[model samples]
Target chain A: MSLPEDYLRYPLRRRGMDQDRYEWRPRADAPRRAWPNGAKVAACIVAPLEFHMLNPSGKPFKHPGAMQTPYPDLRHYTTRDYGVRVGAFRLLDALKRHRVRITFAVNAVLLTRAAPLIEAITADGHEIAAYGWDTDTLHWGGLVETEEAARVDKVRAAFAAAGLAPRAWLSPARSQSFATPDIVRAAGFDICLDWEMDNTPVAMRTAAGLLHCVPLSNELDDRKLLIDQRQTEEEWRAQILEANALLQSEHDRFGGQTLAFTLTPYVIGQPFRIWALDALLSALATDDAVWTATASELVEACA
Target chain B: MHADPNLYDYWPYRDRPRIAWPGGKKLAFWVAPNIEFYEFDPPANPSRPGWPRPAPDVVGYSQRDWGNRIGHWRLMELLDKYAIRGSISLSTALIDHHPEIIEACVARRWEFFSHGIYNTRYSYGMSEAQERAMIEDSIASVEKATGQRIRGYLAPALTHTERTFDLIAALDFWYTCDLFQDDQPQPLKTKSGKVVSMPYSLEVNDVITYGAMAMSPWRYADVLKRHFDQLLQEGERSGVVMCIPLHAYLVSQAHRIRPFEEALRHIASHADDVWFATAVEIAGFYREHCWDQTIADIDRRGLARPGVGFAP
Candidate 1:
């Protein structure tokens, strides 16, 4: 829904903080003094990388029915040889080939299992972050099964085992617990990358505090356009170009904002998919206004 | 048919604050009960403003047309196609009439949650004991049909007596969705001091907001994608829960199924960032991890403190 005209007439308000007349902040760290005369965008390779023997192919395990033997393959495979290293390396190679900085929202389990790739992504200057460990997407009120304190302990244990400190987290499947922000901030993240208001950064305040957010536009995710069988690739590409063009325009209209595209390794990390991505990036990059950066870097720039 | 006045009031003061968890992400997933069309006695006048006028060739004992069956099957197809599972909040009459629907749900092992005997059968005027009997009877009927225990109850339009929770818990059901609090599941101490709320959402409920909102299939998908993006972004800093509630009947419709396909496909592809789970699984997770003294403490504070706050 379009924001009600009165929506702006009265500034958006949340408790504990008075609403401000919306003001756009110029970034001291933005590479350009003013976003070039066109729409500007920042791209982050946001991959929810999964690793585990149970979820080797990132599919849920199911009990085998009557005729089935001891176990059945309840898992789904995206590509052959479904190991974290093989898939992740392919992903790393693609991002590196594109010279894109990715924010690996590592499922803690996957990060631990795929240490080599985690280190490789880290070594490649891409950011390594948290995508909750065992709880698939959101806790759904089920984490440790008892106390919130125990739940905190489980998250800590998973992160500690990974040997990497993450300041930002992405919910599994975009799922969140109300307690997530407080828990994440308590865990020490300064920004959240989960908002989809517009293709610009907006500030979200929670009980923890004000966490800067990079709003994601749904138009960019390939799953919506291609995988869901809703649109053909040609149509999808046109939509992509159209959306990017619009964001570039919006950025030009509203200065100093960052636009981000969150891509999945399973979708864009493939060979043919890489081409579509390349075509889109090539087109956007030609515009001097748009620049691609890792999500963490954008977070740092905005916060 | 007048809308409940309670639906419009914003308990803004009750809006949850960002509780700070210093160690790890707090993730929550909600499994919502979407019961589309269970057999209901046709609208008394049959010419009601909000409902569809009955078709000319309507058949059988109920005099109901299965024009909506195509949509229901489509919903089934999509859920099966994606391997997405959920709790089917069912009306008893729907289960009694369409045993295959229950069979389909059971085949997928969808969580069986009660949604009264029919869409029209609210527990509104029922005595407390009657409400309890409905609770007991619903559980027995659903468990027998689905071959799985029915552990949760979502009142018709969230209608029920104050003792609903206690009766639900007393009936040995695991959770109830009569309340929408923080995205996490927490105990709600009634005056009777029993029964708790496992969070569910009207915010995320799709039938009224998306389906009846006349949102296009693309926009419906976009709505979910947008919410996913928001939750994931928010989770990056401090984790949070995102819930998408569906109704088998509404989303199963020809126009609405595409969004379901789009949403599940989008979410599944990002499997690493999301956990696709059933409501029961989520409830189990919350009980284990997020629910505790903090929640009980919040409940004990007796409405003064509002939503849970992390130990700042």
Candidate 2:
């Protein structure tokens, strides 16, 4: 049997991006800027502090680290919480030893549940950015505008209620609807780190105005390397160092390059894996060419 | 569906028809750059939906879009550096969608073969006429744009009907990148008498490894080198085809591209044994040299079905 008549039709096929969220600039043409200290590369490490609900909605799709077993899934819930409880501090101390300040993308739910943890992160001179409602409430394309807006507002309200203002936004799982950029911008976020389209920063032309985007490295993250890819910690460190070296060379050729990697406590913060993070930081420390900046600093310097 | 389609017989790897590439090179290496376009929203196929998230999967869509905008140029320049002409597995609608990309690839003398009109379209439940029209449209679109006759077919998004092979063969295509049972080009039993299953690989494919397998860039680089080494070693016995199918969306990220470039550099360094040819050239050489012997070998091994003939 044949398909429907309209199946072959190409309605919106055209020159540039199908959506108008951002202008497409090729790598040679993508915007780049010099680092503050004449450094060739800027490393923006994302420290994600999240809360995974026991019973995940998983409406469209389940997040990578979302609960896997049946209800009362304490096994996964506590495993993820271990990031906030024990692992984050271990990595934080290691980061301090390397003398690098990072951006902590705090899920809005964590503002209340881990209030002292958030306070401690701020006290230690790390910047805070807004992650979505929790690890489970992802903003997807099918989500209704009003429903998505309400969720977006929850991030602001949760942090505002805590008398803290975070200017950057990263969607949970980095999933986004067509209107996510517009909504996030209208809600007054200066920077968003969802799109891993490029290593460089870009100012997305949303309906609400310009929202600066700093791409997070989806491939180089700890969950991707150590967990998903099932590579050893040694392999993970090697991959990160290789990525940094690649970017460093590109920086030498071009203007400047950004090497952003995510350090999740549940994944990279495990007692066995923390040394790998230490090794990575120690290696970057020796490289005087690298300027470790917060996500905001990256947006300011590159965007 | 039968247990096996019985398209190609159980032809063993060893002592087959010897395939000698140009310059007596043992390995015919090709870069299959899959230049595809996925629709933001399209009428869903009864077989498979267009996207995972409801309608407009913004992250997935824009990430692919980044390939056309940013990734392609980076990958193209790297290929140019190695003097490797990409045998592009093109989504021909991109000919209309982004002709600048076409012009650039054409300038490098790249070979364009049909992937399909849009990658979003699948060949799962089409009438015989619909599949023909879809295939022909890609041929015409690519022909009109670059003035190159596409000699090969890769099913759009690799979705196919049972009749896909027979249909493509009937339309006078020289090669199909759809099959992966062999590392060297082999014959497909088509009504047209001689249609080659060009040695396009899924394992070495960037989308499969980088996206699906979640491979780290350097790990991917290491795999590429390892894959090439194995093929080069095997090529001495019988000429082997090593195809590295790349998608700009996955392979050409800033951190990723450099390692891929190094892998290419490593592959290209084996100048004597590795003959860098397009899919069409590989097919043409096979037809000229290896087809009759291969058919005879298949018959000698009792692998042939009745009434199969090589178009001599």
Candidate 3:
């Protein structure tokens, strides 16, 4: 059995990355900048308020924290719904208590559907960034440029409709098509939080212009730690503190470091796990060297 | 289709041939840091797609890129502290994409072997000739880059056709890290020449343990210690091999590195008991010492009888 002649050929094999969306700028070579307060670490906390549809097509691939059961998965539906409903308030309270200005990555459908939730988040004086249309919605490579671009524009338009200007964007599950960066840049956004190539913000070489990529690290993410890994609350806090310690030390030796991570309401907002979030926020506050900033503040300082 | 591959004969892991490593070391240890390069977008094989999501796959692509830009240096420095020269499973195209990494690995005198052109590309539906050309291209790339011939193959993304083993044997590669049958290196039973299946473990592979299994760092560190202790104890009878196949992108994260370091420190403490070696070195030693006896043992055991017979 044989295949096409072009199968083994690598068309995009080049000196730098195979794609042109970004350059292969190593972290070692990147200039390290100080945060606004002369702090060594920029603590960027992102909280995604997503809504998983009851019936998912599960195209391309099933994302983490998606509905696991068959149709009418009320079990998982309510589990995730709890995040936007009851859990988000607990998560917000913790951030508000610490006086930390966090960014809320809201889905497009959630903008119109959950107006009260949107108003609550906005009224709390936190930055609201763009998440995708919904958890099931995807802007993947399988989608054509026009379709993907429309999705980005649709999300941007929804943000405008809500009377809230989105300075940042994070894709649902952080999935993207080849045309995502160009589309995202064309939408007139300042930064995207989907690419996590470094601890510091990077300028993606988008055709629209240079799009600042503020990397929200998935390493110590609350959902990954508490939900996926089945790690104990203590283990989760320890890992967060441990990762922060490492980044702080790296900042001291190198120049700039961002301790950026995502906190899910359904995951970390659970009563048991909420204590861990409280402990982590308190622990991070104790470190005067740590500078907690919103996504826009981070990109402005680093990118 | 044949029920079995027939490439390797079934040889039991009981009392057979006893191997003694160099300097009478009980265990042979090697670390394979897969210095891989996942293309932003590659030609898709009809049987299998490349990225989990669609093309571009900004998240998947950037995560791997982070390894080269950030993780590789961190891992390289840690390995240097332990005086461990990693036998890099390289995506040959990375020789062009990132030469600085290649230069650094060369400076440390690390062993280089072919892991195909790009990790994203697979060897699914290819003419034997085309596959051979791909293999030849990889060999040529490594030779040109490092001024050294590669002696091992772990196919790109571990995707392969049935003819892979024989082709690699014909190409005169010494060993393959693809197989996971035995804890020790064994004759791969190739048609052309001697090719050994080095015990490149999938069990404790960081990609499996960390990525697939979603194991926490604390647990992984403990697993490493226990895995090493057990292998060391087993090696008392005959020599055994313990390979840690790693993806720099996964393990080099700041959160995971400390736990990994603790495990490495535990393994490195047994300097006298372990023969810190590379894949090729282990395969070379196995070929020179254990190849003949192991092949004969397979013959003697009647485990691989030529004539087909039913169990009934």
In lDDT terms, which candidate is top? Answer: 2
Instruction: Encode model 1's per-residue lDDT on A1-303: one tens digit a residue.
Output: 697677667454554335231234444433342433433656554666653221222223221110111111111221211224233554565566667676777777655444555667788888876776543334444444345335544665687776766767666555555566566666666556665544455556555676666565556565555444444344656676676666566564455555555555544443234455556656655666666666667766554
Clashes of each: 60, 0, 1
lDDT of 1 by residue, B153-248 (tens): 787545554355556766766667665433444554433333445546544466645533445666667656655664554455444556677765
lDDT of candidate 1 at residue A42, scale 0 to 100: 62
Instruction: Say what the interface RMSD of candidate 3 is.
Output: 21.3
RMSD, one per candidate, in order: 17.9, 21.1, 21.4
Candidate 2 yields a Cα-based lDDT of 0.81
TM-score for all models, in order of appearance: 0.44, 0.52, 0.51
Q: Best-fitting candidate, measured by DockQ? A: 1
When summed lDDT is taken over every stretch of 10 residues in candidate 2 chain B, the lowest stretch is B303-312
Model 2 Cα lDDT, one tens digit per residue, A150-266: 999988989899888888999998899988998988888989989877777878898889988887888888898777767867888998889888888888567778888899977
In angstroms, give how far residue A181 of model 1 lies from its true place. 42
